[model samples]
Target: MIEYSTLKQTGRFIIILGIQILILNQIHLGGYITPFFYPLFILLLPFQTKGYVVLLLAFFTGLAVDMFSNSLGMHAAATLFMAFFRPGIIRLLSIKTEFEPEVEPRIHVMGKVWILTYTVMLIFIHHLSLFLIEVFRFYELGEILAKTIISAGFSVIIIMLTHFLMGSARKT
Candidate 1:
């Protein structure tokens, strides 16, 4: 039988996936920004989660989004890359003494600075990989770079806002 925790996580994933596809996918700032909040799901997974599980979840999440967005495999590649690098990023920015066991990442749990740094760095990496893959060539390097940075910035803001709102709800 599936564990209660696993079932809850699955339900939450489905809800987030629907919101991402039905809501966020419709939002675009003239090709300059596309808020990709789905990555935050993978990002905020418990730190103690196994690397393989993270990678698999990231791959499937990207693939699902790609299916909905009709962007082929671009999302999958970028997301998997982000998942692969997340552990190292956390290790780099996290304080060893403050690390907790099996804790999910959150602004409240990790503090504002750590959360901000973690989100920015991961968003940058994810956006860069995604833009590069979407371009598939270096002909419009400047345009791609601009789009990546702008989109990443927008995505970071949205993700943080969502995190804060969710955190507040959790406390109530």
Candidate 2:
């Protein structure tokens, strides 16, 4: 059985994924800038989480979105792609201080710069994979780049706002 706290976390993940698919996915600004918050679930997961666990969560989360959005592997691929790199990015930007493995990457815990840098990097990787797979052609590189940038900006904002609003910003 999943631990109580882990269950609660799972519930929150489901809620955020729902919001992304049922609401945000429908709002494409100028037909391109669609907000994606589901990836934040993966981003917000505890830093100590095992790599395979993270990959599994990311795959299912993106798969859930893919099923809803009818985009078939785009969300899953991008999310899984980010999952593969999340550990590296965290290590690269993590301050030279030791931390418990279970500490979450919340804004207050890591500070705004760390949070922002981490989110931006992963979101960009996710979005780039998403948009590139979407176009599926090298010729439309400009369009893919634009879509990735605009969508990533929107995603980062939502992730940060939601992270703070959750009242979990305990700066340690």
Candidate 3:
């Protein structure tokens, strides 16, 4: 039988993925700045979550987005890269040497600066992988950089706003 926590996590992933594929894709604040929140779901996963499980979920999430957006494998590659790198990033940047099992990566647990830095770094990587793959050329490196930076910044703002408003700042 699936555990209750697994059920809850599945639901959360579905809702966030739906928002990304349906709502966020339709809204363009500009030509360059489109917010993606699906990464926030992965970012908030329990600190001790198994690596393979994270890779699987990130794969599914990216595949879902790719299906809806018809962007081929761009989302899949980027999200998978982010998932693969998540643990190292957390360990490298986090202040806490120890955490309770199932600790959620939130501002309350990781503090403002730590969480902010963590989120921005992953978002930048995801965006860079995505935009650079789409562009597929070094000549337009400047454009790729601009798009990645703009989209990542916009995504960070949206993620932070939601966390503060919903009190996702709390440790879970």
The TM-score measured for candidate 1 stands at 0.92
Overall lDDT per candidate, in order of appearance: 0.86, 0.85, 0.84
Instruction: After superposing candidate 3 on the true structure, give the runs of residues whose Cα lies further than 4 Å from its correct spot.
Output: 168-172
Residue-level error in angstroms, candidate 3, position 157: 0.3
lDDT string for model 3 (4-94, tens) is: 7789788988888888888999888865467889998889888988889999988888888899888978889999989988988988986
Off by over 4 Å in 1: 97-101
lDDT digits (tens) for residues 1-172 of candidate 1 = 3376578668878988988899988987885467888998898788887789999999999999999988989999999999989999988986573455457888778888889899999989999999999888664888888888889988999889988998999899
lDDT of 3 at 158: 88
In candidate 2, position 113 carries an lDDT of: 81
- The sequence of per-residue lDDT tens digits that candidate 2 reaches over residues 1-172 is 3487689787988899789878998898886588888888999888888889999999999889989888888888899999999988988896554567667888667788888899999999999998888779664788788888988999899888887886464443
Which clashing pairs does model 1 show?
none
Structural similarity to truth (TM-score) of each candidate = 0.92, 0.91, 0.90
How many pairs of residues in model 2 come into backbone collision? 1
Candidate ranking under TM-score, highest first, comes to 1, 2, 3
